[model samples]
Target: MTVQLPPLPEIHHPKIQALFQKSDRELVTLFQRHPEEGQYFAAIFCRYGQVLYTLISTATRSPVQSDYLFVKTWEYIYHEMRVLDLRVTTPRLSLQSWLINIAAMMINRAEVPPVEEIQYSLKDTPPVFWCYLNQALNQMAGNLRLVLLLSQTFQWSHTRIAAYLHAEGESISASDVKQLLVRAYQALEDALPEDIRDIYLAQPAVTA
Candidate 1:
């Protein structure tokens, strides 16, 4: 079947556009060699960090955790650069997607919002539960966290998430990703306050 691609959104910032043009290896090398280079990297992060963080935070529902995961993602990229090599034909999906995937994995490893606690939310009704739910998910590991963020917060399609994983050299099915995402959302809602549970539940499902 033929697929329809989304309209290309403009990356208007001249400086950031330049950064994106460089290979990941190049950017990482720059950051690693110069202690002061962090300031420059931070500028890049600051430019697009919110969009990335918001995508992550919404998926996991935690601002505090998103902050931590975001920083960790950059560090990992820097560390990976030491021995990593990318072929010219690598799958292309903007640098932000790459970073967001790392952030997601970090959240998954943390394993916050245990299955048992998720079930608890389905049973109880509390005021301002979504706040707590958001907090709990934020505490989870990066992978699961990013999955939720991209699927729920950014409203990306499961196919898109799958395509991203494939680009990163990870093998996962879009259907499998969708299943995990469903569980993540259920857990998130379970953790929310009963008062707004219906509202949260009623919100439109995320789409590409």
Candidate 2:
């Protein structure tokens, strides 16, 4: 004989809908001011939870790893939110990018089984383009490279990056990261072919 399971509790859909109406920045502020009201935090999670999960899953390609990273990322976000200074930390990308950045660091630390390498070269151009890009990235200064990688690869905000670098004994600030990122992009653009440079120029401005 099979035992009957109890039905799941109904979620307050109206409350969730109301939460969705508020912007991420607004929700964050509300949560910060009223930490006891968990709905505000729940609302923020509802907005970006699925997107973050998808990103983690795609990167890790393992259900167990993805689930672990997903939980860890949210934990970091919650802790950071408590100490976050809204004046300095602008949610330029509406907090989604910031969340993804945290997830990326977790992804980087997780050990994954190695996969076979496959190289594919487009027939449209010479292979030197790829080489040039790699060379440009390699030749960048250590600090410049760190800022570029953290900003471009991880989508970390300038203020977050500044704190990370400062903790490592680097004398830097958000303004410095912004300037260094601009210079790094310029150098990379100059190193690329004109056509590729134009494509890069057409892309949207990088949110700090």
Candidate 3:
């Protein structure tokens, strides 16, 4: 949680620390308005680095791929910051949503490994994919959603998931974990919007 970006502790110097104190909108303005001052952009990066990393890592499920996309996402942000007009964006996303959409876009665009090795690799998708995915997930049952997220995002084994639930006093057996996962997949498919389903159908099937 601490800002440890090298050579520029965003919270170290009084002036730099002040950048951290500003709101996202404020930080964004400084980032755009004063492209020469990296402190503003650095502050935003330091603030959201963990969040972005978590999002990328969960989606990719491969440490190596996650690392690559994490850096690339920021690189994209750095290059596109000037032209990003949050106010005028369709559907009008806040800064955080915009950042997430960028990550989702990048993840979708990333090349898939050979089909044999592609377990959780996602296909190229429209930005609306991320937007609607949140809504679909919200519609799923609590237990189903939790199991699905843990399996897909964390790549947790069924036994690991059972142990996790057991420790939490839920006593979910591994067999139950398997069943829950099946239902979870069905639930997710049923919950997704029609457009998203169409998008998935349009893509070549990924054998996972």
Candidate 4:
């Protein structure tokens, strides 16, 4: 598939190093304010680009399709971030998870050839389950919700989650990740309606 994508800023751009010092939220804020400044977004891409591409590529198993979705995902992020309120997205996810969510949305929207088997999208999900699950996740505290999304949606290790959180300015450890996940699971069960749980159990597992 031939696709059009905006060229990334030069790797040796002088601002890249300086922007790297800023955290994800900081870079997001900067990009929000100055949509014309590509460097801030570039730095964000540098931080998670490989993981994001890997996610899309892993799910697609087609480099051409992966490249198309990769570009589309960033294109979505480029616009979405402009109006994105960090406070109250449905899933209340961390930036990494949020980015992956965008990629998943894009992936699900694409027409997969009959030969391909995809994972980690809401494609086959029941609508009621989707709504209820979002509600359940949203009911949790920010840290717990973020931890659960990272752990369950992306299957990131506690150490990886802790390290990423620490880099984002939180003071946390792997022990904290495990403890929060325990609470998150309980919180999810309490937040979900019982009938929805029964319905979800009978369906194919939904992945983010």
Candidate 5:
């Protein structure tokens, strides 16, 4: 016969529960102050886990790769938090943006397979609309196109887009990324007809 084991104690506490209500910055600060608490990090994970998962899924486009990147991104964040000063490294940085930056780096390093292009028949949608859309995309500058793809297609944050561009030896700032996105959208709106533009505008915004 085996002896019975004692039940584990509950980990809940009023102070720890309060961390869930704190802002990202506030939670990070508390975590920095009390590295051993673990609750602060748990709070952060609960807040941003889905956002980062979406970003990773979009970037990898493979369930297995997305799962790996999701875990790796958080591992990188935890390592950085333990080794660096969060106040110095992420001063005034939105937690979502910071997490996206880490995810973007991991995605860049991974070798993701190319997505197969879906060939749509002209009858599927208005051929005129497709033509106008192509023209609009073509009119965008190469850098602007890249920024749009990163922001709209991959659901990257402006900060992540800027950082990725900078890593690729392009001198870009987050403000520049925002401006580029605005210019791209304006160009698309200008190229499309009024009806098509309205249709496009009614589409849901992409988020990461």
Candidate 6:
């Protein structure tokens, strides 16, 4: 069954609320004439950058690619917003969802380099584990992987993870976040190679 994402929050800050409330035409005009609006634009990036990185990292399974894609996505958005007709009538596709879909498409179409390019050489130690982890992470989607990394690697509290995912000012129930974390961990466990899986399973809890 598909999981339901929580509703997005409204901008509470008066300045931000005012910016968002402005017509698309107004925003485009400001962008073209003001140019220095980049200062205020940071507010949007500050709020969504981590979430976007989390999503792209899970999809690309490469930190380098994730970094690249995240930047590219924003650049694309900046360009598109400047030229967007802003007259669309689709009720279901908000700006966030539209950008997400574009990101997904860009990620899927991205070309993976040859194995040689991916090889990591270090002094005396093999990077095999990282390679395996990347492969396994790519098998899962962004949301699940975010849950896994936050819950397993970072050991963030369920309430915190829920707060990030929900985007709502209110925290989600701890039980709900716990369930999502469990499922993400299970998926990662199943995707891992047998040898690596055993090692990961045998390891003690990761320190916060």
Better of 4 and 6 by TM-score: 4
Task: For residue 53, give model 4's deviation from the true position in Å.
Answer: 0.4
> Which 10-residue window of candidate 2 scores lowest in summed lDDT?
2-11
User: Which lDDT tens digits does candidate 4 get at residues 1-208?
Assistant: 2322224322334556677678888988887887434556667776776677777777776655566566557766766877887679876878888888888888888665443443423224422234446657877889889999999878999999999999999999999999999999988877875544543443555899
Instruction: Estimate, for each residue in 65-136, the C-alpha lDDT of model 3 and write its tens digit.
Output: 665566667767776876788889999999889988888898889663543453332223322234345557
Would you give me the overall lDDT of model 2? 0.62
lDDT of each: 0.52, 0.62, 0.68, 0.68, 0.62, 0.55
**What is candidate 5's lDDT per residue for 1-208, written digit by digit as tens?**
2221122111133433566668877877776786534556656665676677777777665555455556556666865765444455635566677778888888888554333432333223322234446546777778877888788668899999999999999998999899999988887667554544543334555899
Task: Please give the TM-score that candidate 3 achieves against the real structure.
Answer: 0.48
Superposed model 5: Cα runs more than 4 Å off: 1-17, 83-92, 111-208
lDDT of 6 by residue, 149-192 (tens): 88766769988888787785545677887887778778876776
Q: Predict model 3's lDDT versus the native.
A: 0.68
* TM-score of candidate 5 relative to the true fold: 0.42
TM-score of each: 0.34, 0.44, 0.48, 0.48, 0.42, 0.38
Greater-TM-score candidate between 1 and 3: 3
Per-residue lDDT tens digits for candidate 2, residues 1-208, read 2222122111233444677778777888887897534456556665666667677777776455455556556666776876665456555544777777777887887554433322222222212233335556877777777888899667899999999999999899899989999998887766654533332233555898
Worst 10 residues of 1 by lDDT: 1-10
Off by over 4 Å in 6: 1-29, 89-92, 112-208
| Residue pairs in candidate 6 whose N, alpha carbon or C atoms collide under 3 angstroms | none
